[model samples]
Target: MFTRILIANRGEIAARVIGTARRLGIATVAVYSDADAGARHRDLADEAVHIGPAPVSESYLKGDRIIAAALATGAEAIHPGYGFLSENPEFVEAVEAAGLVFIGPSAASIRAMGLKDAAKALMSSVGVPVVPGYHGERQEAGFLAAEAARIGYPVLIKARAGGGGKGMRLVEAPADFAAALESAQREGRSSFGDPAVLVEKYVSTPRHIEVQVFGDRHGQLVHLWERDCSLQRRHQKVIEEAPAPGLPPEVRRAMTEAALRAARAVDYVNAGTVEFIADGSGPLRPDGFWFMEMNTRLQVEHPVTEAITGLDLVEWQLRVAAGERLPLAQAEIPLAGHAFEARLYAEDPARNFLPAPGPLLHVAFPDGARIDTGVGTGDRITAHYDPMIAKLTTHAATRAEALSRLRRALGQTHIAGTATNLGFLRALCEDPDFAAGRMDTGLIGRRQEALTRVPPPDDAAVLFAALAALDLDPARPFLGFRLWGSASRRVELVSGGTLVARDLRLLGPRHVAVEEGDRSTAFEAVAATPDGFRARHGGRNLHARVVRAGGAVSVLLDGRITDFSVIDPLAVEAAGGAAENRITAPMTGLVCAVPVTAGATVARGDILVVLEAMKMEHSLRAASDGTVEAVHCAVGDPVGDGTLLVEFTPAARRPDEAADG
Candidate 1:
């Protein structure tokens, strides 16, 4: 085993690697960018080094800097944890050439699977059931169009070197193919430095299932069963599970064998995953799955596989990299119960799942589940990296039981300071099709409106917060001795777009009554707690963590966070509201494109600006038909949140009120 190793990554994966390395008594070194100077992974490791600035091109992707750090820290090997330089074949070769081990597959193996078109061809040649599509080398737009026509409409255009839903587009008709291809090529070039893409027939109802395989230098290999990653949003996985629910036994056997064959074809070693796109129109069949691509490193969803197998995959990687034999043969590998993993990300589901990066003012994960995370309270989810806060994993005797535990665990999650997709994840857990295991890649897209709708916070909890905010005394207002005089006050609070005024009267010590419209509710035990207050209403006890910053009050109750902006009668506001057709940056990020000029006219839904943040490209479209009055940003400009990117006025398409926020 390696006496010391360096993790060439950041976030949870870096932290995760340190955990296993420490357990094995291996000294660990962590590399961080300027943005991650205070990252948990840096502190968790035995030693830390600063590589470069926050931009990936300057930091995490600088293999030479990472190698220097590793050598300086006396690391025997480097572990690329799934992202950054994880799958870079050149980086792997460089590490090996530097007289240090690369704790993953060889450079040749990664190169073989680097490009989707070539990977598919290789798998098809090896009889691994490649998906039917255009895997040719021609990159001409017209040639690709003809191939898409030959395959059929509803073709999926994927970047040859893309992963994580980047540079992927699904075209439903021939007319939309050109635009999607251009967009895909642009994103692919910017993200992966490769503009080549492949056209594949889109599986209308598809399930993403992958098999985990491990190998050693001693020519021994084994499979760790499979994981179902069908729950996805925007082509990215949101939830994952092991021992796919409702999967047929025969199908599982065939898939596992195929995965081993694919791995063995390239003499693959260490940990890797063979992804498949399966037909989900009916029961899983042996012929329903086709090879998509192979990830040449540990996967983000590997925890689900670990929970089921009860094995430390990272430890296995270390052993294999140190010239040891495989831990267990295919049959010897233990596969017990079902497991589920839900990814909690700092994003706004209601805003089309845009990345919401800010300080994690309050973060609390419930017990009873294994949480793999690199962030906690006081940490910031910057736009420079992925916005994943943590991966919550649950394991049980059965799939149903495991999913139930997952739902319960999510219910107790508390986070504030920025928007999150917790509400969306909770809704997905309760979704009928998801709970019943009738899942597919298109599940989220089909029910996006319902899933993204955030549930309202507990009323009693919000009322108690309002009452507390109304108190003039800042210190222990909830514990005031108001028994001698029952004072009444009216306070106004606004949530989302709704405003309400309520009358609050002290009924007794630590008790109050609130009146709004014709409804009167009584709150008992209204005492202040360390973080917030607890109250009883309608025979139910409610707990809320109330935080007041300036006039904004945020209340978290039962994992639902609501920000209430207190209305002030003494404050004067400017009139005329925000300008029409004005679009601003949603978060701090680099501008990838300025599609429109100052005098250009654009229709609603037309691409105006493309912003790159959290390593993903987001296209900001016009909200109405308007003429651009100004283009304030250009490509490659780093802009902050709410920075005006474009200004425009309605072009008389309809009433201006239709454009009001």
Candidate 2:
């Protein structure tokens, strides 16, 4: 094996590679941009080097700078994790030219699959199943539209050079084809610098499944079964599983064989994935699946596959790069129990899953399961990179057990300082269709409203927190040595938009009575920890981690940490509020275009503006019909959440309508 290797990537993948290298006794080098200077991966590697700025074009994509860093650190090979330069054929050639081994497929293999149209044609010629679509070289808009017409309605326009859904569009009718094509091309150009596109038949209910395969220098190859990546939002994977649930043994065998054939067709070596879009109307079949594309490097969900197979794919990459033959043959590799992986991202699901970036004040991950993370507490989730915090994976004897463990693990996690999709993920775990394995690409979107529903804290939990906060001061005894009956203290708590005022009468060290307005509720408290209280109300056990701050109490109940500005009842009765139609930016991104003009009339749900952030276009819409008063930002401007985009006044008939909040 090589003595030292350099990872030409960042984030969790870099940290993952460093971990494997350490176990194998291989020295590792990490490359970082200015944004990732204090990142966890930088400290994990044996040596680190600064590449360039935060933008990928100047930093991670600079293959020459990466190569120089590798050589300077005495790295014998470079591992391109999965993005940036991972699939860049030219970068592979450059690395090979510098006398350093590229720990992945050859440049020739990557070139063979660089463009979707070309790659589809190549796969078809080699007897592999290719989706029925337009794989021609013509790029004219009219020509592509005709191809879409030929393919039938509901055609997909995908960037020939795109991944991660950046340059993909689904058109339901001929009238929408032109607009979809323009959007796809623009995104493709901005993301990959190549706007070339290919039209394909859109599967009505798609289930994304992919086969993992690896090859050695001596031409020996084996397949590592498949992963079901059907859980998605905005065409990106949110959850994945190995030994796909409800998949049959026959289908598994066929997929493995087809994957090996595709790799052998290209004389492929190293680790790669062959993705497929399966029809979800029935169980997977040999003929029911069609090739999507090949990821020419290690995948983000490779951990699930590793857990099931009991093998280290990165170690295999190192062995193959060192001129070794295949370590295990197809027959020797075993498929064990089921595994599931959930990607925890710093995003707000309620805000249409917008990326939430900020300093991670406290990040606490579950202990039992394996967690692959690139950031820790004090790490800043920069907008210049993906906002993923970690990948939590669980493995067990069966799919049901794996999912149950996954739910428990997620519930045990604690994170603060930024919004996340944890609540949404928790809802998914309890979703009927998801738990029953009736999943498709559109599952999340179909149940979006219910899945993103916010639940308010129970009244009993709130009352316990109020009582606990009162005892935080040691000088104030349990009964306060009161001369009369128990001295009652009034406190106010707000959660999930519901405000409640509680009257706390401390009965004793383990008992209290709470009164909200004229109604009264009894609570029994047991001191679990000095900082938190365990309370029981109406037969349900609840935990309240109470922290005293600014004469108020912040209570963390049921994993949803909330702050309650506790104030004297007489001090807050004077405040009041009104309903308003306030416009706010959905996410931190550049204002790509403002469609509304000053004083223009826009109806409800009208497209007011478009913001581009994290390489995705989000259209800010008008919630009510009104006359536009102002636009707070211009095109090409950077804005954050709640950044005003436009203001509106009611129609002349209701000129005195209430303001928007």
lDDT winner among the candidates?
1
Model 1 residue 257 distance off true place after TM-score fit, in angstroms: 0.7
State model 2's lDDT: 0.83
Please give the lDDT score for candidate 1.
Answer: 0.88
What would the per-residue lDDT of candidate 1 be over residues 339-435, giving only the tens digit for each residue? 9999999998888989999888778888999999999988999888899999999999998999899988887888877788887888899999989
**What tens-digit string does per-residue lDDT give for candidate 2 at 82-123?**
889999999999999999999999988887877888888888
TM-score of 1: 0.95
TM-scores for every predicted model? 0.95, 0.91
Residue 469 lDDT, candidate 2, scale 0-100:
53
What number of backbone clashes does candidate 2 have, counting pairs of residues 3 or more apart or in separate chains?
4
**Weakest ten-residue segment in model 2 by summed lDDT:** 472-481
Residue 15 in model 1: lDDT = 97
